[model samples]
Target: MSDPKSLGLLAQFETPADIMHAAMAVRDAGFSKWDVFTPFPIHGMDDAMALPSSKVGFFTFVGGVTGFFSGMGMIWFMNKFDYPLVVGGKPLFTPLFAFPVSYELTILLSAFGTLFGLALLNRLPKLNNPLFSSERFKRATNDKFFVYVETADPKFSAVETRALLATLGASAVEEIHDTEA
Candidate 1:
């Protein structure tokens, strides 16, 4: 089969420990476009996967700063410049009055940033994956743990990747083919 039509390989492990060891092996082998799926979250899997820190926090921080400043600016513009109103002997533009609005805006924009950042980072709206074509992969969300290595990875070799996973104690190793829609 052509390389483009081959999605990659799927290695199924009978247990979490087996998958964990397999994950470490794959990582050390320098395969980048790979992922592990478990019935539930696995502690230290991030370390095994060698995933870097998330960029979502940076987005949140920038959004919060922008929100706070924009809130302060908007209030100042409206109260001090747009329609100046001096009530109860208070200064026309006191930051104290804008503090509540700014605080709320900071939280609001931070939430928006987090949502968008997660979607962006994860390549969200991904309607389909070639892995979904595997009948055994359905077990991934139930009893089985799986590691999928994409053919698109720089280090991917059909023969070598399959052999590596098989040696890593994978109960079953299967090559996945893309399903054209």
Candidate 2:
């Protein structure tokens, strides 16, 4: 039988401070495939992890622009070209008349953009994770903090990374293996 594959190493921390420090160290060490888990959000964890700004805003902007133009174009085609009509001595097509519909469409599409953008960016619907295999990791949602370093990272050295986590005050450093075929 084939041996289980090494997924990564899971390091447990006793407090928010310990995990925060470990995150910074892991970030500074240049390990890319790593993550931190805590019972609740940490105030400065983003800065500590050195994460980049989210692209979800960009997606929302694009969706809004597309919706607005599409809405306006549809009204223009229906009023000005398809069946032009002069009412109350006013022009067949006018921005003032289309403004409300366009605005509504813009808001609708922007919401959809934000939802889909977040899902795509986060790699959602991830039904499973190697970390879930660790019984101790369950406490992450209750009262524990954890730093997980994936073996896929180029900077991940089994011995060195384990020692680094230990030095960073990790109470327990356990290896995570992928048992699935």
Candidate 3:
């Protein structure tokens, strides 16, 4: 018997090639809700997996633009409109003075956006995971490659999925116990 809380079923692959092959197989077989884990990214895996273009770049773009505008606004407010003061006989709104702080703030905000956006997009900050308790999952960060078909997926069926994995050269298959949220 498997745990009822299982979120997905994991199938292990011995090599990166096997995982990539399985990715293709899964996509062609119309299993869209599957994820593959590897020690490192394999080239062309996304195509095989049929993954869509990521919006991470968009997040970065927004963050950068927001940072730039925010920097410009702050500088303008303090130096020009809000509290204009001539310093060293220079214009109240000196682009040179603004450039340094604006540049620095832009870089800083973009960096923060990258980190925070990635986490938010990935739904991370995961304090706990059932996979951690599973003896089999520990190898994910090490040498082995694995694929999982989430139960939330409409196409998920343990028996059929296991067979599909086996046909794709899965070395081993196991159930994941998804706990209560």
Candidate 4:
């Protein structure tokens, strides 16, 4: 059997301000693998955590560009090459005529990109997590805020990290163990 592994420590705070302070402190302490959970979005948390802007917008842009070109190519191939047709001296293909379909497709593919990109980036479809085993963590959806420092971090030390969290005004700190380990 595998030896028990530490998932790191979970620190609970009573207010948003406390959690924000803890997050900033954790970030300043050079800990990389850490995260904070709150009942709702907290302003300035992203800056405190020093997280970079999301790349999902880039994915959406690429998808939209692909859709636009694909739509134009399909319209051109169908009308100008596959089965040419002339109606009232109109051109076989024109941007004016294809704009509607191309616009619709661009929007469609961009929406798909946003959805799938978010899912992939966030690692969604996860039905379970070790944190769910903690009854106190359940309050994350209601009132409490939590900051978790993962043992995977290079600078993580159970004793020092927990002490740092306590000094940052965490109401309670608990160690999270890896069930698979």
What's each prediction's TM-score? Answer: 0.90, 0.88, 0.90, 0.91
Instruction: Please list all clashing residue pairs in model 2, or write none if there are none.
Output: none
Error of 1 at 144 (Å): 2.3
Per-residue lDDT over 81-175 for candidate 2, one digit per residue giving the tens place of the 0 to 100 score:
99998889988888999999999999999989898899999999797987888999999999999999999999999999999999999999999
Root-mean-square deviation of candidate 2: 2.2
Q: Name the lDDT value of residue 45 in candidate 4.
A: 96
Model 2 ranges off by over 4 Å: 85-90
For candidate 1, the lDDT comes to: 0.92
Misplaced by over 4 Å in model 4 are 1-3
Off by over 4 Å in 1: 1-4
Model 2 CA lDDT for position 101 = 98
Better of 2 and 4 by lDDT: 2
Superposed by TM-score, candidate 2 places the C-alpha of residue 18 at a distance from the truth, in angstroms, of 1.6
Instruction: Tell how far residue 135 is off in model 4, in angstroms.
Output: 1.5
What ranking of all candidate models by TM-score puts the best one first? Answer: 4, 1, 3, 2
What is candidate 3's TM-score against the reference? 0.90
Question: What is the C-alpha local distance difference test score of each model?
Answer: 0.92, 0.92, 0.82, 0.91
> After superposition, which runs of candidate 3 have C-alpha atoms over 4 Å from their true positions?
none
Clashes (N, CA, C under 3 Å) per candidate:
0, 0, 4, 0
Residue 124 CA error for candidate 1 (Å)? 0.4
lDDT ranking from best candidate downward: 2, 1, 4, 3
